[model samples]
Target: MDNNFLPISREDMQKRGWDQLDFLFVSGDAYVDHPSFGPAVICRLLEKYGYKVGIIAQPDWRSTEDFKKLGKPRLGVLVSAGNMDSMLNKFTAAKKYRSKDNYSPGGKPGRRPDRATIVYCNRIRELWKNIPLIIGGVEASLRRFAHYDYWSDEVRRSILIDSRADLLIYGMGERQIKEIAAQLAAGLDVRHIRDVQGTCYCADNLDHLWDYVQVPSYEEVIASKEAFAEAFKLQYLEQDPIRGKTVVQRHGDVFVVQNPPVMPLTTAEMDEIYDLPYQRTYHPVYEKEGGVPAIQEVKFSIVSHRGCFGGCSFCAIVSHQGRIIQSRSHESILREAKLLTRLPDFKGYIHDVGGPTANFRTPACRFQTERGACKGRHCLGSNPCSNLTVDHTDYLSLLRALRSLPGVKKVFIRSGLRYDYLLAAKDDEFLREICEHHVSGQLKVAPEHVSSKVTRLMGKSGKEVYVKFMEAYRRVNQQLGKEQYLVPYFMSSHPGAGLKEAVELAEFLRDIHYHPEQVQDFIPTPGSLSTAMYYSGINPLTGEKVYVAKDQHEKKLQRALMQYRDPKNYDLVYEALVKANRQDLIGYGPKCLIKPRLEQDRPEVSRKQRRLPVSRRRSAKRQRANKR
Candidate 1:
């Protein structure tokens, strides 16, 4: 048997002539043996450093047999709830069961339990009480502190507290994981790993928390919304690695201390991780069960960078990945594009080559790399920072390199772009190139909202930026003589979007003459500045009152306003219009979102009333009042 995959079974381990393993990696996903999967990267990194690692993926949590299949490792067990949070993977924003689990084999569901990290750790603790349990992933990283849990609808303690994990790594783990293995190999006690950067651990005393910045305690944040808001603001402020301090929150007698995030990876480090041998697809073992479905989107894609400094208030990037952007080398990306052409499924297309924000191939400016992203400000928000150096020359050259590959017919960038960043570029070279070759029919951009008030609440730029971007996109595509459309994504019911603001967004959509196929409802996920605002009726940073749509019915109205064309949303749209005192937008007029629910079907508007021209309806009402 080949060592193509890290041993998933004892037999595979024996094939490699190993009697013991250094780390037993457990994941909630089926073992795909690809770099796109975090576990694959960690295990491969360990293997490269001469650590014997074995992966037990999607193991049956009901018993300990699957957990012990490869036997306990000498060092510890690495646990992650796959690429996505288990709750998000299993449920929708509406708290409904998702029909399919894309990460599971054959699109199956229920392969892993809810809160898989906690469940897997419990099982490990029950079997081997002393074994080290390290937890990290989307769930653990984003939920690593006292924060909100939307599903449970409560202020939950850190995952380190609930999972009883020995160490919790946050953000990009490539640097942190290797440091961990080296320490463990050197016979350091796992509990003493509290000193490691980018990790959170539970300590029994307050001695180690001497230099840590203490936030509101668990009880304080849970009992009072004001306390929670204050705590979130402090938490948000101290997340940058360069300027961030150690944060400690008391959980009863114990303390959950989180060290500052790991420094962003260098170009060489990113290249090393990307250059490591990855099978590029799910293990051949999954070939019969239709293979892992998540691989289809990523097998041809390349992740060019790591973090986002955009600092969207509703996003959790600030809490987890940190604001510092760590990018891969152009050589590393070109090497991967060439590798994609060799795949049997190659159709001469490179699906995507980007990370969180595709256009962000470098630090916003040179100062960010040296001193770090500004702790007091955002790179892209209401206004681009003057210090922000926006250029697409490097990213443009990288795209050109990929497009020049021999078999590459097209190189499409499916990842979303930060339009503000694109607009800040010195020229339209990247813009023209994207419209001419990269765009596949329509380019999807996130304008989010048109109202400046709501956009500011969402920590987005002014509507004027979107207007400017739309004009530029059209101009570039027009110059290219292409008919590629720009599809702008909108979000409804975010903080500060009330009936009035929602109506304003509807008016903007009408003027644009575009009806969205699907609309997004602002989900208050853990660790986002928005979630704090959602739970507490105040903006954490500014201490200003913010309106949040919590009621299911009201949320539906806001969502329907965005997609008023759908027949199913007619009633909701009508109700929203009436609620906003916007009956003028309810008629058969060109600007109307929905026709006044027919006079016969509903008494909202009668035939004679409808026949009155929209321009004179108010005058007609005045005439009736005069006659009376």
Candidate 2:
């Protein structure tokens, strides 16, 4: 193997002067030696701790031949379904197969199968039945519990039970993987390794379990929607690392026990992980195939922090990365930026400097580090918490420092920026600085929907907050003599969004005279509160019933309303306006969403009007108007 990358083949292993590997990582994505890729991070971390690691990227699961090529590892095998969920990466919100997979070589499809973690593990088992198999990554972490699967439209068993792996690491696995490796190297049996934090393992019974919260069994959740909601609520509340307890759920005779999440890394720990010796690009083997397409966006980006406190229900960040923020020191980020300047393709532009939510450099409040995030309360929900700390001094300083670096012309904040948090800050320096230096031609923000009812269910601030932010943004841009615009992101067919609310959003867009180029239809991916609501027709946090657009046609109508100005969407928009009892909005007026159909084209027009000639119809209408 080249000293720059982990061994990929037996030949590479020979070149590395190694007879066998300590750990072999099998991923559903092409090998990209960058920190943004989860598999790469885990492999590099293991290698840093003195383990001989090799990667087998996107191995063929159709047969056992590819699984045996890596040979049996001395320690165990690590499996991941790449950076995204397998089903989500393969299919669209409409449940149609996508033409391409960005993570695959040359952006081609079918390189990885659906439910990749399960398939890969099955193939590995066929080759060696007794090897220790550990699964992690976004796919495994989000589906750790018995949760809703959008593609299957059913509540499924825990991934730990389904994959039949000895261990499943959830969340960020740096802390858990290092410990597991040490114990395994010490000759501990995989079956007996059940106490690691941030991991889940199956048990035959509860004989060794304690201080755990038992959720509804798999059968109960499958049998009843209320039970499913109850189970999701319990799982959601206990995700905190400080106050969280071990979560246990029953699947047939087997019990899947999940230990409390690993603590958020400190600044020093976060710096160490990002400072690993990464080649910072896709493996050379993929060069003939034009490289993995997913690297384009992240290749020049810097992850300044991890985790989010924005608390949007439709997002899975809180579920996977936890709400506690873990940020890298400014020195570490500068080092990475300096490295980017030396790359052969350096273009004097850093794509982004943010994570799940930018401008969140610290915990939501001072108490989150000592006590866990408060249960059942959001820091920046519709009503901001009184104790929430809204500050951007540190993030501003980092941006200023990066801008001052040599050969760096610009640094943008492309990640989701919580506008409500920005508006809440005591001073406007951060906002002013962003408007002056950070923003590109247009800034992208997520207002989601204008209706208060929908925003409330989304765990977002109301429309009034968005309106306030918009006004403030415009004022700041005018002061800076910049003409930047806001490209607000809107969603369609989310839970609690009926035709009435959809029409309201359409009207809001109409009044603004801005039509969105694209609309995001809600896809109920696993491990999100919105998906639970879509499955059970009830909000898990609160017991209130919510309206979900499950039928394909209704979803189409909702999506059309977001882009009502499109000529192709006229029919769907007209149907939605009538169904919403807002027919007044479909007329020849300045505020009308669509023009009235010609008399001859209107099937619903009265037969009397159709029977008269055009000239006579005008005369009759004038006579009737005079008489009235």
Candidate 3:
């Protein structure tokens, strides 16, 4: 579990003849093998490029002593902090946001720095001093700002400055990583590596750096919430290593930084990366000794694709993967599946496939190195253009091929694949295949919010889109003769949502008789566009007008919406309605608190039993049933 106790040491590097190493990948969390994606994939890709890479997973990164164990490398280090789990304050906000909704004792689940990455970076800075530490991944990528910190409950600076890393590469690093390696291999110093796309590093003089991408400053965003909200389709500002500056931008904010991908993987190169021999275990060696469950116990999932054209604000995929959809070839997927089947505990099903917003196999439109086609940063944001290519043909073909492979029974799309994109498909064959084979009895979908205004602010489609998707889902299920239910995911207490909107949502739920078993209160993870809105009550990148549900009372009303079906919540709902002065919600309304209120009123009536009319008292049973 600890890097110090790791069997492999510097001596092992010497024994393996790995001198003048090409890459040193410092992983921030526990190591996972079988799924074989993320930083691990990048590591394998570097090996193919003839680089001797060392993977240090889950280092106790608190001190410099542990960092010195790993010998120095000729090339700069590759750092990835993984993705955000949850924001502490966002979780706290959820408690008040949905006071009626029962939550676990501790609070909403949130995440902090992975012990390995945090400790390793601190130590790496102490030991290596000036050596380059190129940081990437969701955790490191998003926290490049001085934003609200829920745990300590305050605003903090960028992780790059905190960790003291050299270069910060946001988004997918396949293309960027290759370019960084090639430049270093060709004897180009890290100081002159400004041309690389999807990368951010510090420089002494800001003007000299490739014209600083024109993104709104944090101060501007904090001042005008609306402008910040409307700025970028996705906003994640990383810290520049050289100048100690930050690379911040709005999703659709401005056209400042447009550095093209240095080496966007072609279909063939993607094939090569996925085809690498992956053990596919979180701890590959541990599985053999029964330290963990075998594949038969838990199915391994892999991502055949990344990115999405849909620019829904609630989603961070477009910001992370960009609007361009990149994919792994069918051949590569099949090979990996075959390898899974050959494993000792191989099951007849491929657990899941896809990433970011899965099913988005290619760009929404023809992507060019010259002028970009995706003006909105999300395909679903504004309408798709005439040139926009919405094709499920290749993706469907990949799905069918994987199912045809031996030892593959089911291939689930566990990741959130945009329903809008799936709905855009002209043919029903893919949907049919999915309904018949891919789905379990319960299917998961994220409709986020139902209110149009809230949906707009959250950067998601309104209730209508979700309704249409539901209809489509039913049609498919009926055609397949399968009894499946779509489990819809909804969010409460977002930046712009208030009590009125929450009550409206409750009414909407009442009308549809849709009572979700689980409701998520919004958690603002680092590097997300919405985080800015939640923190500053404004959009940082663009100076647009925006609303934020930051008040504690406002959050409570939103939480009340989720408990409409429970009678125990009557008093709670009644209080919320009374406080809001919304008498309309008092009786048989979505915000009705009559059940508990009536029960409470019963005790007082019991004390005055003799005052009740005999006839009225006899009919009390009938009255209760009718009211209920």
How close is every model to the real structure, measured as TM-score? 0.95, 0.96, 0.81
Model 2 pairs in collision: none
Tens-digit per-residue lDDT, 165-266, candidate 1: 999999868888889888988999998887778998998877746576888999999999999999888877888888788988888998888898888888
Best by TM-score: 2
CA lDDT, candidate 1, residue 410: 92
Q: Predictions ranked by lDDT, top down?
A: 2, 1, 3
Kindly list the per-residue Cα lDDT of model 2 for residues 1-628, writing each as its tens digit: 1348878999888987889899999999999999999989999999999999999999989998887786899999999999999999999999999999999999999999899999999988887799999999989999999999999888888888778899999998999999999999999999998888899999889978768899999999999999999999998999999999999999999988999988999999999999999999999999999999999999999999999998999999888899999999999999999999998898999999999999899999999999989998999979889999988999999999999999999999898799999999887788899999999879999999999999999999998998999999999999999999999999999999999999999999988778999999999999999999999999999999999999999999999998998989988998998899888988767888887667526655467876778798778778878998
Count of backbone clashes for each model? 0, 0, 47
Q: Mark the 10 consecutive residues where model 1 has the least summed lDDT.
A: 598-607
| Superposed Cα deviation of residue 417, candidate 2 (Å) | 0.4
Q: Which stretches of candidate 3 lie over 4 Å from their true place?
A: 1-8, 18-22, 34-37, 85-119, 145-155, 207-212, 216-263, 284-299, 367-370, 382-388, 539-544, 567-570, 588-596, 600-615, 618-628
